[model samples]
Target: MFGILVSAFNVVLGFVMRSVIAKFFAYFVMWFITTEFVSVLQSAGILPTASALAGAFGSIGSDVWYFMDLCSFSFGAPLVISAYATRFIIRRIPVIG
Candidate 1:
């Protein structure tokens, strides 16, 4: 699912970004990009199979807004949290001289 994909993306992004910039900025930028990407896909109706599945769940209403919100939050929350947490831990360990 998208949630799993987002989590994996975050893990990779965190690893890559840490070497390029400060932790906070890296985390913020990556999180912003990922969230924006998801939002854009939702708004633009570009999500894979979304249109096809729309009719199947018609009784629930159009577009499944709640489901999208849930997916985004479920996927994005852990990534955002881990981004900062991992950085914090790395920074905390005393370097062996």
Candidate 2:
């Protein structure tokens, strides 16, 4: 029946959406952890990072914030799509009760 198929689709959609969110968050958290670890490693060595010229060699501080921001969006866009699709499906569903 159409209703039964819709029910299965709904369940699968929810599962897939949740899976995507879980994976993205897991990877994002790892990035945060790595950043902290690297920061500590840099500071522990008493190295000054103010000079941009020495950045490539890991002796100076380089701007990694921009790159992180760019990469974060690749994960965020899917979340946005999943959220919108969930909303649209819920709205389109008819209540039989």
Candidate 3:
């Protein structure tokens, strides 16, 4: 499920890049950076541990897929909100445009 979301995001990013080479480059760099950042966070225990995340659903007798969806919403919702806010803020910046 998370894999699918990441793949879909890549496709959208590809369209934004507008060139085959640029698309590939962007995907690779984004993947590398995201992978590393997640790794570091996991290692630092900033992000939930896999076993802990699984246990969270198990305690409530829910499946991992549902938990993944919940996690997606938990993270994605704020990001979408922030993106909108950032866009508005950037447009209002007199020097940016």
Best by lDDT: 3
Give the range of the ten consecutive residues with the poorest summed lDDT in model 3.
88-97
Question: For each candidate, how many residue pairs have backbone atoms clashing (under 3 Å)?
Answer: 0, 1, 0
Tens digit per residue, CA lDDT, model 2, 5-33: 99999999999889988888877876666
Q: Per-residue error at 72 for model 3, in Å?
A: 17
Ranking by TM-score: 2, 3, 1
lDDT of 3 by residue, 17-82 (tens): 788778678668756665565566568986556587567656654475587687896688558856
Tell me the deviation in Å of residue 74 in model 2.
34
Off by over 4 Å in 2: 46-97
Cα lDDT, model 2, residue 26: 75
Query: TM-scores of the models, in the given order?
Result: 0.31, 0.38, 0.35
* Worst-scoring 10-residue span by lDDT in model 1: 88-97
- lDDT of predicted model 3: 0.66
lDDT, candidate 1, equals 0.63
What lDDT tens digits, residue by residue, belong to model 1 across residues 1-97? 9999999999989887776567667568666666665566567975536456456546664367587676895578558766874565445434311
lDDT of each: 0.63, 0.62, 0.66
> In model 1, where do residues sit more than 4 Å from their true spots?
1-21, 48-54, 57-97
Worst 10 residues of 2 by lDDT: 88-97
